[model samples]
Target: MTIRILLDTDIGPDCDDVGAVAVLHALEKLGEVRIAGMTHCTSSQWGAGCLDALNRFYGRGDIPIGTLTMPGFLDGDSGYAKYNKGITLGYPNRYQTEPAPDAVETMRKVLAEGEDGETVIVAIGPLINVMNLLESEGDLYSPLNGMQLVSAKVSMLIAMGGHFPAGKEWNFEMHPASAAYVVAKWPTPIVFSGFEIGAPIHTGRSLTADLPDTHPLRKAYEWYVGEGETRHSWDLTAVLYAARGHHPFWELESGTATVDAQTGANDWKHNPNGNHAYLKAITSPSLVAEVLDNLMTR
Candidate 1:
């Protein structure tokens, strides 16, 4: 059976998110997964447009795209808006003019519509949207609350955040409170693909070299890392493991993970029965990059 995936991303800040979406689309075309929905956790106005443009580029233009509506998230003016602008301007996007629904509401609707224990959520962004979803009360979609709905529908959460045994990462640090809350209270098993797992595994050069200039993936990589240059496959790693379970590429270390809400610092303690686990690289970075690049350029 193909895995049903709901992607939560902050696509504007990093080009890796675009690569990640491309990887997901590639797997989708191969009958490995179905992209149920996409949500952006950033406040960037162009976020939904970027997502919609990329989905359209992959010929999945009808996929729903939602954006973070909650206040106090990342700003609309991000340094990476240039790439997002390029995508929205250059590609065919419906959301560029139509406003997207709230991320929390979109997530709730998707989860409610999903089969029990079948939806895998790949979050490659800040935890704000997720935190809001978890703390949300029952709505029209389902009577079950956020945590209950997640426990019922979600099989696993594959998150690309944090640094290994200890340290801070961008996703976690961007919204520390949400990270802390989600880490402490999330109902399902979460597998984190940490910074160390993706940092050395570079990609994008192949995508830019092979894909046409009109392709959003090529444009994103070209503008972010320059033409024929590589970038870390951070978000792509999470989406990869979410679609295909860990085997040849990685190992898992089960532990209790904690993030200081104030500082965004993270630590892990070994616990055989813990619901949280972080990925440990087993395959060489170059090999993994080859796998990801092939998928991206496919």
Candidate 2:
């Protein structure tokens, strides 16, 4: 059965987000998933633009793209201006317009529209949007917010956040409070594609070399790979794991997660208290190469 997926992403930090979208499109083609909606959680002017560009590239422009209201940070600077400054670097023409709809509201609408227990949330960015949903609607969705939500409204929350062994990672670090809130309060099963899993799967080379510049994916990839360097496929791993349960590069484990209240680090231990999937990294260079090749070709 095809899983209904709501993709929450932060596309501008690195170009691999583009590749992640490509992988999602491929999964849709394979009939393994459906694109319910997309929420951009970077809380930047360019965040929405990045989402729009990717959706347009994949011929999914009609997909609802919502922007977060929370601010974003830079490499190490957790300031609003850092995100605003980064916006100047990509698709300047698109940022001059008004922002898209509120991401939190869009998420609520999507959840309302989904059939009971049928939606899967694949979060490949900051946890702000999901956190907002949980905090605002937790009481009303007590049954559908925690483990019950996991079994009912949500099949799984495949998140590309946190780090293995509970260290700092950008996504989790950016809004550590929100991350902690969502993981602790969420009522569903979560599968984390942390930095340990995605950081290693770097793209070897451009797969769009043969395609003309006019090709949407090709143009997006070209623009993304500005410095003639292969990008890291951080978000794509989450996409792959979500669409195809086995990637030959990840070992899955059932564990309970404990969130550090002060720091956003997540500690996972084997337990029955919560049903969360922690991904352990494995060697799968071949699988990465094959997926990259197929995405570029298709």
For lDDT, the strongest prediction is 1
Candidate 2 per-residue C-alpha lDDT over 96-198 given as tens digits, one digit per residue, 9 for 90 to 100: 4776777877776677668888888999887877887775544332434433434466767898887875677778876788788778777778888888776
> What are the per-residue Cα lDDT tens digits for candidate 1 across 152-251?
9999888899998899999999889999999999899999999999999999877655887777788888888888999999999999998788889999
Instruction: Please list the residue runs of candidate 2 whose C-alpha ends up more than 4 Å from where it truly belongs after superposition.
Output: 71-96, 137-152, 214-228
Q: List the residue pairs that clash in candidate 1.
A: none
Per model, state how many residue pairs clash: 0, 6
Give me the candidate number with maximum TM-score: 1
Model 1, poorest ten-residue lDDT window? 71-80
Q: Quote the lDDT for 205 in model 2.
A: 61
lDDT of 1 at 259: 95
